[model samples]
Target: MNWSWLGPPMDVRPLFPVERGAFLDLLNTLTAEDWERATVCPGWAVRDIAGHVLHDQVRRLSADRDGHPGPAFEPGEALPGYLARTNEDFVRTARQLSPRLLVGLLDRLGQELDAMWAGRDLHAPAGLDVSWADPGAPAPTWLDVAREYTEYWVHQQQIRDAVGRPGADGPRLLRPVIDAFLRALPHTLRDAAAAPGTAVTVTVPGPAGGRWTAVRGAERWGLAPAVPDGGRAAAEVELAADTLWRLASRGIEPAVARTRARLRGDEALTGAVLDIVSIIR
Candidate 1:
């Protein structure tokens, strides 16, 4: 019921331990065979993804320190090709060392990140323009670095799933990251219209309830509270937040959402609501 703005800038110090702890816990549990299993990320086995994550941490830290804009991904390279190349490089490097050695590398990298963040002013201007492969993508800076924590957690889950291990960390660790992704959704979805003159509510069902309202207008869009008159019934559609997040991130199917979602005013509005969330990922 609380409509507070989610995913604002956070102090990195408090967040680092949680992120590092989760990473360490995950790596500690992996057997050699577990690392060889295929991950959900295409072209990446579990070990390959783990290696890439480690590589990213090192690269991002170097970029942050040297004031280099993060890696320049070539626009000509397809997403799969770029990721495959990066993953292969990481896996090859990791393969040269023992798993213990790889874990040590991650620890050293984490310590470097901790030290850099401890002394550095995150808001300070880094004198470079970093771009992602996506057109109109935001620069890869401290903000992106913070968001990477979320990616780390999610991808860690992929590793867990591949190995048949349970993800014991609760929503608390994921909340900030999820909030960050949700906070950016409106701007990303503005250009995609699911319907005109329709106000929709998206409810994420959990122990703690969270809701997002998207109203379509003639020339613009507005986001507000999905309360009072805008409960689940007043809105055109409603869904579990986890379901929406997974679908938005392309971790799940829109068709699955269509079947599972509760519809109210119009079915078209459900499609529109999905359209709004879809662009963010």
Candidate 2:
């Protein structure tokens, strides 16, 4: 399950065009009924998901490409709540747009997004932090872009699941998504009280999966591709790549993930691994 071929600091900028092309192709093949089908995103249908994707592109283009700032948080609002409210608000209003219009916008804006990403310096500080990965700290441009790829890929999978028209699940597409999501493992176990040198290894056993170990350091847990030399993992968790993606993205509940996952070693560490979520919610 270890991805020795693809090393750390995943550069997902190369993936944007391919994933976006696949997204548009998938949208064009949907039937009228398919647009109305329910997706794993609670209460959001296929069209809603499409509209959500459109909204994401528009917001990114405006903010990143055009340097336009987005709306500020309301009084007393939290990050997760603000994001949830704004996303739901957009999807609700977007329900009025025809499917054709949604796809058309995605086509145009997707190109802009791809271009924007192409011009970014991967080593520079990102516009915003990937909160789940390194909360309150500036993320590198590469990690930010990788997070964007995972978002688009996960939402596309949601649509495919609803309509039973799967595509873009190959190792090329999914491996980066899994790797990007695994960046959040350190933050996920941030509060866990573990002695230095303790390590937890998570393995997704499939073509698209790989191994990641989060080792406890003097002050924090750090995620890496391999465990340190002579260090044995204090806990290990194993699951399919499909389950890992869904679990990381909140497509499935942790209770459900626990049933599907195999656990060994410390219960608290394994439980923290199961609770790892890549999204704001």
* Each model's lDDT: 0.60, 0.86
Q: Which tens-of-lDDT digit does each residue in 252-273 have in candidate 1?
A: 7778877777777655555656
Backbone clashes in model 1, listed as residue pairs: 194-272
TM value for model 2: 0.94
Model 2: pairs clashing at backbone N, Cα or C within 3 Å? none
Evaluated against the true structure, the overall lDDT of model 1 is 0.60
The digit string of per-residue lDDT tens for model 2 on 1-281 reads 22221136678887888998899999999899999999887899999999888889988988888889888899999998988888889999999998888889888888888888889888778857788887777788888899889999999999999999878999999999988888888889998889988889999888888788988888778876577786678999998889999999988889999999999999999999999999987
Candidate 2: misplaced stretches above 4 Å?
1-7
Segments of candidate 1 deviating more than 4 angstroms:
1-13, 68-75, 78-84, 118-146, 194-198, 216-237, 275-281
Give each model a TM-score.
0.75, 0.94
lDDT of 2 at 274: 94
